[model samples]
Target: MPGEYGYPNLNDNDWIWGGTLTDIETTLTHGIRWEGSDATRVNYMPAFDGMFDAGQVAALTSHVLSLSGKAKPNATGAVLFTENCAACHGATGAGLPAMGAPALNDAIWLYGGSEAAVRKQILAPRHGVMPGWKDRLDPATIKMLAAYVHSRGGGQQAAPAAEPATDVAQAPMAETDG
Candidate 1:
């Protein structure tokens, strides 16, 4: 189960970053928000304590719950979510793997799924940090770890390769982490 101690579940498809072999390798090498590694995958969801009032937070929480069919939908919550969360979580709350954002439309949640849990998270989000193992483990060991993790039931297939451009004038855009 996820959120047992702020760590994600490796056995489920609701990956916060991604579930590919390469993605797992990268995460194990640099870690997620690890202070020791400059290449650590990092992204922060700003705390909304000061940004929203009690009622507003409740509305937003309800809206988030509604995404997973756990609560009644709130129009104000929808607007608030669009204005504040769409950039990273996507317009439909599907999430962006590149941005390390978790999908909210699914029933799978990193944290608890209750109304109170959602409200607390809305007020003050918690960000988990995973330490990099590159310094502590050899490349082969890391590869093995990646392999083991990839064998989990939730592991995803590698993304399809992009087609090469025939036009020299057209160059592939560089993708950057958020």
Candidate 2:
């Protein structure tokens, strides 16, 4: 599914992946966790069912829900979140893009944002995957698509032009190696 996952606009620099044109191109060509791209990206949040007790999960959910001011702060939940989730999702739940985590402080979510939805996710994590287009599109065409995407309003400024290096000799590689 090419769903935007409720993320902010792509052209405005809010990227789980980097926002450079090359970064966007790589994402499009390889896809995330899809079999087609030789270098597909893949990361997943672990399900915390057995990892945390019901009480702890409840607390974390409370703290996370409270981030959007949807729930009142619960000391137990706040403590649990600080100890367990602060690593990937900043202490304030701002989310660390390098770890493929999304901000929880904001209402935006890949999954629904209700308490029930949040709890279910904690108990059973879900990961979204994008299929790669390299197998279906030529590099030239893919570059064209990237250009169009980069032209969007959310697109960040392109990196300064670098000296064109001689094309590194390379040969076509197999897909799905491993």
Candidate 3:
């Protein structure tokens, strides 16, 4: 259920952008890489066609497959993964939600999970686009849609807000001795 055609399968818990209500609403409003909207959720994985040779591409592909335990791990692939793919996809291929990178360590994949499919993607990355409903649909409709999607079993809670940093220099003096 992870891969639905070329797009991500919503039936599962793996969320590329996010599964929270707010996150879902934002995606529904702006869309993913939709050119029609300025606020589209955009993240592009660069094609390694010209960047690396065929051997290197194969190594990278092998590495990706190995992440999900689909193939045997290779030293060449590990080195390539560390040097090239670790920034966004993460060192362990766990993925970074803020960067819109999917977890490669898991069996889930946006596209097909075959070795050939992985190789093709690494060679010439395929980017999917979702249309924004702000221009066509009313705000109420969008909100309702978001709610519906959030009700699905895969929905996730929003991340907690970061704690505010304390200003050590602004500490108040204690009056206990007075």
TM-scores for all candidates?
0.86, 0.74, 0.85
lDDT against the true structure, per candidate, is: 0.79, 0.70, 0.78
Identify the runs in model 2 with alpha carbons over 4 angstroms from their true place.
1-13, 157-178
Error of 1 at 140 (Å): 1.2
Task: Give candidate 3's TM-score.
Answer: 0.85
Residue 25, candidate 2: how far off, in angstroms? 1.3
Tens-place lDDT digits, model 2, residues 13-32? 45565566787788789987
Clashing pairs for model 1 are none
Which residue ranges in model 3 land beyond 4 Å of their true spot?
A: 1-3, 161-178
* Candidate ranking (lDDT, best to worst): 1, 3, 2
Cand. 1 TM to true fold = 0.86
List, residue by residue over 1-178, the lDDT tens digit for candidate 1: 3346578888777778778888899999999999989999998888888998888898889998898898898999988987887667766677677678888888777777889888877788988889999999998899899889888768888768733212211221222211
Q: What is the lDDT of residue 65 in candidate 1?
A: 88
lDDT of each residue in 13-45, candidate 3, tens digit only: 887887888889999999999998998988899
Tell me the lDDT of candidate 2: 0.70
Q: Report residue 129 deviation for candidate 2 (angstroms).
A: 1.0
The positional error of residue 12 in candidate 2, measured at the CA in angstroms, is 6.5
Which of the two candidates, 1 or 2, achieves a greater lDDT against the reference?
A: 1
